[model samples]
Every structure is written in structure tokens, then in C-alpha cells.
Target: MSRMKIALAGIGKIARDAHVPALMASDAFELVAAVTRHEPPEGARGFRSISEMKAALPDVAAVSICTPPRGRLQLIAEAFDAGLDVMIEKPPAATLSEARQFADMAARAGCVLFVTWHSRAAAAVEPAKEWLRGKEIKRVEVSWKEDIRIWHPGQSWIWEPGLGAFDAGINAFSVLTHILPGALTVEDAELRFPANKDAPIAADIRLAHAHAAPVLAAFDFDQRGPQTWTIDIETDGGRLALSDGASAMSVDGEPVRLDGGPEYHLLYRQFQALLEDRRSDADLRPFELVADCFLLGRRKLVAPFEDF
Candidate 1:
């Protein structure tokens, strides 16, 4: 099969760290151009805007958007107008309403759209899901604490009005929504916002399901030392734990082997399959969970965050 000519939008940290490497290593797509105001990666051509990239490389059938979710709806609309399949990063849009429009636009344009949750693509996620089948889950506890200085550094957009600790916490929600048996509803939550920032720096969310277990999630972006991303689930069968962002797992104190090498690589593979089948894969449940946190969670003021 011929490789699909593709362009990458946004030349930020994530595009360089994950998307570019995955696209370069992918067998299904060719990275030909980049839509960025700044310099693109070493080999790919760079354009000031998506319009220029589309005009220059009309054969490019797909575009992978790695930009922040603040103004991503416009970028996606431009991609669709250019007649390209779209693949978006996690936490699809700034709001659930904007996220929901991707599918509608894609369907109108007859283009394939994929909104990815990278954590759910981790190796241990599927195996954990398989193990949890037909088991009675007693409770779920998530500790997803990380340093914003290390991960996002000086990204001011993260602390903007629409995102905060939930930016990263949504990954945990995504994995949980994917691996669990049923949908979760937020019961109550306590959100702590930095005095200087509009978004919250920490959140303690309580979630429940109609038939499944209750979930308690603690999310923080102010950790100084070792980072933690762990999900411990107690089931009738035994205790199941996922750590290191679901790249590693252990069931009842026994480690389970993980097969997928990198989450982004697996992510692109799935996107290729979607393009081949002419299908759109956009699941808003994770985004919805995050939305619910903001909707029903109580607010608290905290000390100003000054890591940047």
C-alpha cells in the first residue's frame, strides 16, 4: 500500500517529543510538511499556515494537529477545508461543545477524524481491561501527581481559564473510562486554584457509577520530587494496579508483561487503521468526565504557583 502523505500542525514540545518521532517511524504515513510559524523539524517542510501547506502539498491527505486546545477548532476547520483527515491530541478541545463539533464537521466533509487519548493507548490498559471483565470492583483510587515545571515548563496556556490540573488528570479519566466496565459520574469534587492563575492547581474528585465502584482521584501539579501516576483498583478477584501512566501493571502483586513499545506509536497505528476503514474515532467520554469535574466541583483558593 502507498504511504499517505501527511502534514503536522503545531511545532511545539509534544509535536517534537512524540508526534514527529512516531510519524517518522510509522510505516503507514509520510511526514512531508509542517504547519507552523516557527521552524519545523529537521527534514519536513515548514509553512506559516495550514493554507500554505495545503496549497504547496495538495497531495497531503491527512494532518495531525499537536497544538494546544485553546483555538484548535479553527485549525481543525481549516484542515477539513483543505480536504484532509484529522488527528487531534488529548483533551480534544477547550470545551466539550467544541470537541463535539469535530465529528459533525468531519462527517460533513467526509473526512476521517480521530481524537486520541494517549494514555488509553498504553500497553497495560487493554490487559487491565481484560482482567477486570466480570469482576466486582470494590473501589478505585488514582494518584496522578506531577510537576508542571518538569512537564509543561513555561506553557502559559495550561493555566488559562479552561485547563489546569485537569489537563493532565484527563489522561487518568481517559484510561479509566476505557478500561472500566461502565461510565462514571462525578458525585462531588474539591478544586484548588492557584491565587494568581485562573485554573486549578489541584483537585480531589469523587466519582461513582451506577453498577461499578466508587472512584477517588487526587490530581496535583505542584509535586517537587518523584512524580506519581498510579491507579489502584480493588476488585473481588484481587488488587490491580497500574503505574507509570499505564505502561506497567501488576495484578495481585504480580507484574504483568506489557507489549506495546510507545503509546504514540500505537496511537498512530490506530489512526492509520481508521483512515483505511474511512471511519472516525472520537470518544468524548473522557472529556465529559473532565467537564463534569469543573461543573460540579467546589472551588478553593491556594497559594500562587510560581514554578515558571
Candidate 2:
């Protein structure tokens, strides 16, 4: 089988730490080129833009876009126009409208467009989904708290209005939407914007599902001791907990072990399979929930935050 030639856009932290390693380890993809305004590290095939990369590496069959959500539509549209399959990172696009536009364009072009939600590929996720299938869910709660200063460092785009902690929160919601049995809609929410920034530092969200269960999701970017990424549920079977952002699962307070590996690997494998099968994997339900919250929720101002 011929390996798919792949180009990476936006050689930032995620492109370096996850996508590069996953592509290197996979036999299905070849990392032929990269597009970034910043210089690529030593030995990396570099281009100032996607057009340059495609021109230089004509064999590139696909482009993986790791750019921020706010300015992704133009690049994605360009890639599709160049006749290459595209893979978009989590949250797909900055707004629901952009996501819909990309979906439509990809359909018209008849090219594969994958919107990756890496957390949904966690080892424990499938098992948790299976366990929840027949159970009666009474309530759902998701708490994702971490120190943005430690995780994001000097990155400034996250503080932009369309990005920030909600980005991570959307990832959690993606996994929740995947594992849960039914669709969900945000009922109410509180967005806490830092006094000095355009994006919110924390979000308190309420969701409703057709199962008649009320779901509450809380995301905080200011957590300090023992960083937490967990989801708990009260179901007829028992109390279920998914920690480490769905990397581990427990029921009735008993620990359930899980296999550990880089989640991006699974995502890339899935992407490869989708391309070969001539399928598109674009699910915007998670982002829709977040956008709905933003559209309907009340906002409050909080103390200014600094990256330190």
C-alpha cells in the first residue's frame, strides 16, 4: 500500500508533541512537509505557507491543520481546493457557522475532512460507553480544572475571545457527547471572563438530554493543587466516574484500569481508515453545545488573569 503523504500546518506545541510523533509511528502516513510562519526545527521540511508546502511537495496527499480555531476556515478551504484531504484539530472551527461551511465545502469537493477529538480515542472510553448503554442516567457532572499558566505557558491566542479555557472544555464535552447515550443541549451557563482578557477563565454550564437527566459541566483554568479532569454520573446501575479526561473509568467507587498510550495515535489511525473508506468524520455536536451555551448564557466579569 502506498503511504499517504502528509503536510502539517501550524507547528506549535500540539503539532510537535502529538501529531508529529503519531505520524512518525504510523505506517500509513509520511510527514512530507510543514507550513508555519515560525521556522521549523532542524531537519523538518519547512514552508512559509500551505501553498508553498504543496508546491514544494507535490506528493502531499493530506494536510493536518493544528492551527487555532479562530482562523482555520481559510486554510482548510485552501487545502480542499488544493485537492488534499484535511484533518482539523479539536473544536473544528471557532464558530458553528464556520464548521458548517467547512462541512459543505468538503462535501462539494468529495474529499475527506476529519475533525479530531483526541480524547474520544482514550482506551477507557469505549468501555465506559458500553457500560452506560443500558443504564438509567439520573445526573451527569463534568469538572475540568487546570492551571493555564502551566499548560499553555506564553501562548497568547488562548486569551482571545474565541479561544481560551473553553477550548479545553469543548474537548471534554466532545468526549461526553461521544460516550453518552443521547443528545444534549445546554440549559443554562455562567461564563467568567477575566477582567483583563477577552475570553472566559471559567465556565459553569448546565445541560439537558432526552433521557431526562440534567448534566452540569464546570470548567476552570485557575486550579492549583492536584489538577483534575473528571466526569461523574449517577445512574441506575451505580455511581460512575471517568477521570483523567476519560482515560480511566470507575463504577460503584471501584477502580477500573486502562491501557495507556498517546491518544493521537488512535485518532490518526481512524483518520487513515476513514480516508481509505472514502468517508468524512466531521461531528460538530460538541462545539454546537459550547456555542449554544455562549449564545444563551449570562456572562460575568472576574479578576484579571496573567500567564505568569
Over the stretch 1-308, how does candidate 2's per-residue lDDT look in tens digits? 87888988898888888999999888999887888887664456888877777788888989999987788988988898888899998878878899999889999999999988988998778889888998888999999998898877778888888656788898788888988888898889999998899988999999887747999999999999888899998998999899988888999999987776889999989999999898998998888888888898788999888776
- TM-score, candidate 2, is 0.96
Count the clashes in each prediction: 0, 0
lDDT (Cα) of model 2: 0.87
Deviation of model 2 at 303, angstroms = 1.0
lDDT of each: 0.91, 0.87
The estimated TM-scores of all candidates read 0.98, 0.96
Instruction: Give a tens-digit lDDT track for model 1, residues 46-78.
Output: 998788888888899999999889898889999
lDDT of 2 at 9: 89
Off by over 4 Å in 1: none
